[model samples]
Target: MGVMNELINRQNVETLAQVLGEAAPGSSWGHVAGAAAELDGLSLRARTDRISTALLADIRLMPEPGFPTAARTFRTALGSAGFTGWIIWPVSETAVTLALETGAGPDPAGDFDDCLALLAELTPRLTGEFAIRRLLDRDLERSLRVIQGWTGHPDEHVRRLASEGTRPYLPWAVRVPGIVLAPEATIPLLDALYRDPSDYVRRSVANHLNDVARNAPALVVATAERWLAAPDGNTAPVVRHGLRTLIKNAHPGALLLLGFVPASLAVTGPRLDRKSVALPGELAFDFEISNTGAADARLAVDYVVHYMKANGTTSAKVFKIGALTLAAGETRSVTKRHAFRQMTTRVHHAGVHALELQINGIRHGHTEFQVQV
Candidate 1:
C-alpha cells in the first residue's frame, strides 16, 4: 500500500478518538467518541444500514479545511477494515479532494452534467447532509446540471435533490453561490420538477422556490405569476409557496396573477418613530393593516434589526410579531415593542445601522439610525 493509504489505515477509530479528544482544546467532542466507536464496533458483515446513523453523527464532528483528506483517510480505513458497503466516493468529496490534491479548480467531470448524475446517485448513500451540501455549494454548475437531470430521474431521492439542494439560505449548509449570484438559473430547473409525481419531490420544489423568493423576490414573483396563470394541479401549490409572502405584502401584480383570488387579507408596515434607541432601551412602533378581501388571512409580521459591527459587516437578527389570522374585511392595529439589550460579547461602534420590517413577505418599514456605544 502507498504511504498515504498506510497512514489512513493507521488512523483508525482509536487514533481518531484520541485526536478528536484533543483536536481543539476545550472543544466538546461529546458523543463524537461514542459515534466513532460504534463505527469501529461494526463487523465486516454489517449491513449498510447498520453503520449509517453513527457515521452520520460522527462525521458532523469532523472538522473542515482538510476535511477532504480526513475523508480519504476514512475511506482507506474502511477499505482495509473490510467495510465497503458504507464507503462513499462522492462527486463532491472526490471533486474536493481532487481539487485540493492538484491545487487546481475542479475539472469538468464526465460531460457538463456528469457531476449532477454522480451527486444525485450519491446524496442518499452519503452519511452527512451538510457535507454533500457543501460539495454542491462548491460546484453549483455541476450540481444544478445534475439536479436538473434528476428532475427526470426515476429515483425519487434524485428528484428531491433537484429541489432540496438549491434552497436559498438553506440551514446548516453553505448557500449555493451560483443560486445566490444568478438565481435566474434556478427557474427552469424548478419548472421541470414542480409537478414531480413524488410528494417528496413536490415539497422540495416548494421550499426551493421559497429559497429563491427570499433572495431575489422579483424573480420568484414573475415566475410564480406564470405558473399561477397555468392553473395546473402540480405547479399551483408550488407557485403558491413561492408567492404566498409576495401576495400577503401586496407586491404589485402578485394578487392579480392569483386571479385576485383574495388570498387571506394581511396588514403590514409598522412605523417606528426613532432612529436610534439608547441601550437598556425599548423601541416602540404602531403597526396597522386592513384586509378588505373576501378570504380570512393568517397574518405574520416581524422586525429585522441590523447591527453594524466595527468590521463593516451588518449582522441581521429577526424578532417575531406573533401570529394573527385576519378575518375578511377586518382592520387591526397592533403594537410591536422591541427591547434592545446591549450585546455584551460584541461591542457596537458609532455608526449608522440599518433595520427593516418584513410583513408577510415585503420589506416595508425602514429605519437607519446613528448610534454610539
Candidate 2:
C-alpha cells in the first residue's frame, strides 16, 4: 500500500472511535470499530467512505438522530483535544452526508450554512477541502457565496480552504461541475486571495488559478497580467505558479507575462553523455546557449523528455532547468543529470526516448537515446 493510504489505517480508525466514543457515551461504537477491520484493501478515499458509513450508522443509533443532532455530536469532539488529524476527514464527510440526507431539519437553510461553517472550523483540524466539494456540488452559487467570505478569514487554514475547496480540479476531491462549466465564478475569490499574507493560502490560490488555466488560458493570462500591473513582493511567484500549466504548453501570453519573451539565440547540442541508459540508471547531458540578437534575452530554460509508454507511444513531459538571462553576445553552458526509475507516479519503459531543449516558448535541440530494460 502507498504510504498515503496507510495514513488511515487501523490505529487511526481506532483513535477516531475512541474520540467519538468519548463525545457520545452509551452509543455503540462497534460500527466504527469494524471500520478498522474493513480498511485493509481499500484506498485512502475508500477508507474514508467506509469510516464515514460506519460513523453514520453509529450516529443513527442515537435518539432523534438527524443532521443537527449528528453535527452537535461532532462539535463535542471538535471541542475535545483528540478531534484532529486524519480522523477529521471521515468526520467532515459524515457531516456533509448527514446534512444532505436530512435537508429540512430544525432550520433548513441554517443546516446548510452550519455545515459550511463547520467545515471552515474543521479545516484547522485536517482539511475541510474534500468535504466542501460535496457542498459545492449541491449548490455552487450558495457554496461560493458563503465561501467567498472566507477569503478574508483570520485563519490561514480557512482562507486556504476557500480557494482549495472551490478548485475545479481539486486533487482527490470530487469535481464540482459548476466550477468547471463556469470557470469565471471563482475568479473573484482568487482576486481577493492572490495577495494573501500566508504562503499557504496564496499557494492554494495559485493552484486554483492553475486549474482554471486548463480550459481558460486567456482568462488566466489576463488575471495574471492584472496582478503583475499592481504586484506585491510575492505576486510574481503566485502568478508564475498560477500560469505554470500555460507556461508548460508554451502559451505566448503566459510567457510574455513572465518576461520570457521571444528571443534570438545560438543553440548548441544537448550533447548526451551516453547514447543508451540501463533501467534504474542515470543519463547526463550538457547544452550551451548564446544570445545571437543585439538585445538581451530573458529565457525560461526547460527540457522535455519524450518518454516511451507501455503502449509503444511516446508522451512528452516538460521539466524546468532554471531561468537565466543572456546579455548581448554572451553564452552559457548548462549540465543536468536525469534518473530513470520506477515510481508510483511514473513507470519507466525500455525504448528509444528523445530529449529536447526549450527556451522561452520555443523548442531548440533534439537528441535521441535508448533505455535498456
For TM-score, the strongest prediction is 2
Clashing residue pairs in candidate 1 (N, C-alpha, C atoms within 3 angstroms): 116-146
Report the lDDT tens digits of candidate 2 across residue range 1-373. 5787888889878878888788888767889998898887788889899999999888888886778877887888887877788878999999898887755387877889899999988999899999999889998888889999999899999999999999999988889888899999999999999999999999999999999999899999999999989889999999989988888889999998899988889999799999999988999999999999999999998899999999999999999887899999999999999999889899889899999998887997889999988
**What lDDT is obtained when candidate 2 is compared to the true structure?**
0.89
Q: Which residues of candidate 1, in runs, are more than 4 Å off?
A: 1-108, 111-116, 126-129, 132-139, 244-250, 255-373
Which 10 consecutive positions of candidate 2 have the poorest summed lDDT?
Answer: 100-109
The CA lDDT of each predicted structure is 0.57, 0.89
Clashes of 2: 0
- Which residue runs does candidate 2 get wrong by more than 4 Å? 102-104
* Per-residue lDDT over 1-373 for candidate 1, one digit per residue giving the tens place of the 0 to 100 score: 1332222222243344444344343434344345443443333223122323333344445554233433344433432323222234221444343333333324434322343444554555442334345556666666665556667878887677766767766664666676688888878777887767887778777777777776677878787767666656777767766666655555656555554433444446566767777776766777677777777766545667788877887886666665456778888887777766667565766677766766555565677876656
lDDT of 1: 0.57
| TM-score of each prediction | 0.49, 0.96
